[model samples]
Target: MKATVDPGRCQGHARCWDISPEVFDLDEEGHGTVLVAEVPAEHEEAALRAAQNCPERAITVA
Candidate 1:
């Protein structure tokens, strides 16, 4: 699965990072950023959870 974050929608809640720091990161301004877009099969679950935990619905997994 691949993960993506829409910066325009992110409010820097950091829920994504809280759920999966390995897959998600935050900029100095506290915006969600995707550290790894294409998640490995083993990490797909974590990645999906992070996406789901985003309060702003800024994260998308494909």
Candidate 2:
């Protein structure tokens, strides 16, 4: 799976990072950011969870 974060929609919630630090990271401003180009199988579930948990709905996983 692949994950991405829309900078325009992100509200610096950092929820994605809290849920899936392996798949998501935080920028200097604390907004969610995808750390990997492709999410590993072990981290896909967490990635999806992070996407769903994002208050701003700025995360995307596929």
Candidate 3:
């Protein structure tokens, strides 16, 4: 699986990072950034959780 963050839609809520810090990272302003372009199998669950937990729905997972 892979995850991506939409910088334009993100509002620095940090929920994604809070759910899965291993897969999502936060910028200085607390907006999420994708830590890995391709998520490892072991982290796919966390990645999906992070995407779902994002209040802004700025995260995409596939």
Candidate 4:
């Protein structure tokens, strides 16, 4: 799976980070950032959960 976070849509809620720290990170402003260009197989489920739980819906997983 692949995951990405849209800076423009992120609200810094950190839910993505909370859900999947291995795949997502927080910027200086506390917004969501993708830590990896490609999501790790072991973290795919967590990444998808993070995307689904993101209140801003800024996360994209494919």
Task: Say which candidate scores most in lDDT.
Answer: 4
lDDT of candidate 1 over 1-62, digit per residue (tens): 88899999999999988888888899999998988758888778988998888888999989
Q: Lowest summed lDDT over 10 consecutive residues: which window, candidate 4?
A: 1-10
- Model 3 worst lDDT run, 10 consecutive residues: 47-56
lDDT, residue 4, model 4:
86
- Tens digit per residue, CA lDDT, model 3, 1-62: 88999999999998888888888899988888988878899889988888888888899999
Per-model RMSD to reference: 0.9, 0.6, 0.9, 0.6
* CA lDDT of each prediction against the hidden true structure: 0.88, 0.91, 0.88, 0.93
Candidate 1: clashing residue pairs, number: 0
Better model by lDDT: candidate 3 vs candidate 4: 4
Evaluate model 3: give its TM-score: 0.91
- The runs of at least 3 residues in candidate 1 whose Cα sits more than 4 Å from the true structure, single-residue gaps closed, are none
